[model samples]
Target: MSIPATESDTATRALEVLRRLTARDDATFHEGQLEAISALVDEHRRALVVQRTGWGKSAVYFIATSLLRAQGAGPTLLVSPLIALMRDQVAAAERAGVRAVAINSANAHEWDDVRARLAADDVDVLLVSPERLTNPRFREEQLPELRQRTGLLVVDEAHCISDWGHDFRPDYRRLADLVDSMPEGVPVLATTATANARVVTDVAEQLGGDVLTLRGSLARTSLRLGCLTLPTSRERLGWLLDHLTDLPGSGIIYTLTVSAAEDTARLLAEAGHAVSAYTGRTDPDERVRLEEALKTNELKALVATSALGMGFDKPDLGFVVHLGAPSSPVAYYQQVGRAGRATESADVLLLPGHEDADIWHYFATASMPSPSKAAAVLGALGTEPLSTTALETRVDIRRTPLELLLKVLDVDGSVRRVQGGWVATGQPWEYDEERYERIAAAREAEQEAMLAYERGGTCRMELLQRQLDDPTAEPCGRCDVCAGPWYPTEARADSVAAATGALDRVGVPVEPRAQWPQGADRLGVDVRGKIPPGERPETGRVVARLTDLGWGGPLRELFAPGVPDGPVSDELLTASARSLRDWPWAERPVGVVVMPSVSRPQLVTSLAEGIARLGRLPLLGRLDLADGAPDQTSGGNSAYRLAGVWGRFAVGPELAASVAETTGPLLLVDDLVDSRWTLTVAARELRLAGADAVLPFALAAVG
Candidate 1:
């Protein structure tokens, strides 16, 4: 039984914690920081802080946690969005004399210890990702107790809670349910630097009706913004190479795609820049290393995708250059906000590419949950739990989208993931048709705004601030529009040539699938487990991926929807022959076999014929489609895709005879490889027909 902390006591303690956190006795609250902490600790209310970056949003939560714990309350529970942010917050919490610990994917081994400490009441703050809330074991075992015992709940990057936000996530929506279930007197706080009026209102309503919202101007005075319209990928790369060092201090070079990031990083490295690519595909351990390298100024800059967004803190970061524009102004502002946080001045440049709209469309469609697909998933499920692979065999949705749909369904209480897998909850779930349509329309408008930002005539900073509905948006007298372009308008001729040559280089490895997708037997496909090496296709080569920076542009044009099917172009044929010439194969191919392509038959045939002619190999007959076989549509999990094409192709008498005559390996060519199942089935057919080996070649591979 302890006494409640008074207002004066809370204020003194909060100030002490703030000073400790920042390691400066002279440091004071940044306008609303102290008020936010007092509202949580003293008033015990839900609050949302919408301030610009570097305004000490973390200080509010850290100091409030201190005061709450001092009042004999339970430890604060923080739901952070990213691992990098959690790491930084934990370190900051420790500096304030708060015992902080995080349980994320990177530290599963220490969870037991964390739980033990929680039981002993030794931890003052426990941070976890929003995904953790849906985990069956944690939801059942830890969350119930934690909710009742939590002193305060903090949702960092709270914009993710609203679908209208630029970076909405399904898991973040769980906060409403968590808040509803928490015991009375457990204060809640949500913080974000980038949120428009609509997102702010939506988040406030979700948190509760009686929530205190603190809004501020989104302008960054220390940043000088500018946009450059580059017509080609080569020119953008050349500009970066020519001016990367001259920009300012070490910073980030943001790319819209993983391949672009890797490509840019490679070219920069060749030019003696200490940079590395950071993307979703990067390993967890390596991500940590890269984050530290950037923080410590060990690397000049990181070539990154949006995966590097949110929770990365480098106060002295001198510049941020976007190789491609993001789809929305909110996202662009959030990313560029990373620069000039703790510096006097920093350069923020945008090199808008011609291909930006195409990439934008891909991401825009991918994130939206389809109603038909969700219904198909729900209809396929029963009372009993089923694994993702088993569900995939019954549904037509692709793996990534299916997984996202499941998360959405789970958040809506329509499904629940249990010990073994996921099960239907029998809860009614309605597709909010009007709301989804509105959100889609809003996204399109945002895209238009981004385009407007590129065609700049207004103050860049003012445009970004207004995009976030900042009431204080005004000209900063720093952007290119206000001061004229501060960056070079052109690249050196030699740099452009180097970039052009780099993009012109082709050849991407198309690795053969090893094990078959699980649960294929349920779909009437008998294959499972590892593919026999004797029947496997040798490692293959593709002219390029549809997502590559160089040749990808032409490949994307060739595969664009509504484009009429035709024979391969002469330039592509020459490039394909060059790929064959550069191949480091173990043994020369004796012949070339074309895979049946219903969509692009002429293109596939021409490509195979051209390769055979160039290599001086015999042109084997094309494999025939089995009777009653249908053309398989793209998009689905491995198992579903495999089942669709399992027995679709067969080696006809002519191709079989040709295979038998060829004692050495044969080359199998296709136009595009998406799931890689057609190539697998075709290679197996050729191998069964007594061909010594099969080598797969494709014009383009889907990313």
Candidate 2:
């Protein structure tokens, strides 16, 4: 393909300009970074660069704007989230002898000059925040001139637009609409350091342009991840002193609260280390001074809140230590990502006290609403838009419940914000028609992760890697399981044996596939006449039977080839009746025996009846079925059954103990295979307590 004029000459000129600019001692671009800049400028379509901090991301924009201006492409607009970062970039541009300016939240009249320059095609680039673009005056006045001559709309921190992003801002959603409304086919150049696959997709879709992803490997091989379980703040500070004392390079110590930051700094200084503190409460001028001081290695270590990391590109930061647990893994990752920017090995220490877990638990539980409250919020907002403040005032609920209700409403599309207020745009009664179904699905996935973290008896790193969809993961030999036994070795061995034994005892026998009728010719009356009685006819039964046999269950023992000679005992009959009733077979009748070749409806009805009976209050306590797949054992299966029993009898650990005494093989069916609760309870009681084989019923029978 022949290269476009904008692609060839513009990129070549941009590289030349960058080389000239970086020749001055004040400006510097790292090796090979100029090529990255060239590719970004050369691309006729929109592009993205996922470069680490201190890799000259700002230099790419500065050089590209100069090239675009020289190519007569009009002006460029840089939309960033932080105002301080905008000012820093404009100053940096001036130092490089480039005529550049910014119109941010602090300077309203500066935009008029920017607009005039754009009309005359005078300015190279104008940096503004997303919030400023929402202003009616700017949109109506300045945006028109810039749109007609705009070269590129650069979206810094592009991850904010994604729902799965760590910092999701509602205002970022309006960016796509703004870009589409722009004239002259204004292509976008988005940049971020930590976007995963989903974040990359969101940025591409939102920008409405072809994507050029420059994602480097996420493996920070140099940084060693470590966790410290401390009991008190005194001990934590002592540990910090031991690590940071006489450290040659600068480092960051992060705290959650402003007071904690100040206190930690004070303690470190008293310990004879040159230290400083930065928080939101710090004066802007002082904060800037502290950042500069750290960059120059004047301060040995900086004890600060999370505010210090964003937009502060310090490549040589030797270590980043968190005084307490962060709100989420994203926050932790971002903080840790600050160190080891130059591919130099760094250290990250996480000191999580007991209170840290409690704080996290509070946040998680407080963020979700009860089912009834969610329904109530939807009902109150019926077909109307209301602001969040208005809903809080109108809805009779507490803070936690109110936040959860809004989240549910937002997910269900029963409510949405138009402008600054919420609107009820969804069918309140239709659960399946939710617009935020994707959001809900993401939350459910996170919930599964949290549940696993709290209950799974495995390495923590393995769980995190699996949740984040990271492939090619090893055992992470540093976690609790890899370093030391999470459970006693003997206990684990016994538990595995018991779990295997339970399955062995409960599995039933089934007839061989070769002995059964096959193909259309096998469906005749005589062929049907040869079929066995008391087995439900279901489409999925064959699959379930196969699974049971593989798990060493009683599939063969329960369905031996020979017919019974006498009437079956009530105990055996009850077991069969319960199995037929509770199992999710494709077709079966309730309380009615079915020959293997019975009509589908008859089989369906029986199975349905059995399911219904087992689901009823009294009998429901006796059995628990997993959701989705009937053959698997899940935590929810046991939890739901235990919950049912608890609801009926107010039973707790005592009842659980009594149930453990049963010698007969217990057959449990779960809907899903990866339920942590089912695994926890079953492993604890059956394997640890020496129960008979615990068979997992694979088929979902009705009746």
- Candidate 1 lDDT (Cα, whole model)? 0.90
Q: Give the alpha carbon lDDT tens digit for every residue of 374-447 in model 1.
A: 88989988899998877888897777889899999999999999988899999978899898889889989999
Model 1: colliding residue pairs: none
What's the CA RMSD for each of the models? 2.5, 21.0
Candidate 2 achieves a global lDDT of: 0.53
| lDDT string, candidate 2, 544-607, tens digits | 2312212212223333336332323333334444444544543332121111111123332333
* lDDT of residue 80 for candidate 2: 81
TM-score of predicted model 2? 0.54
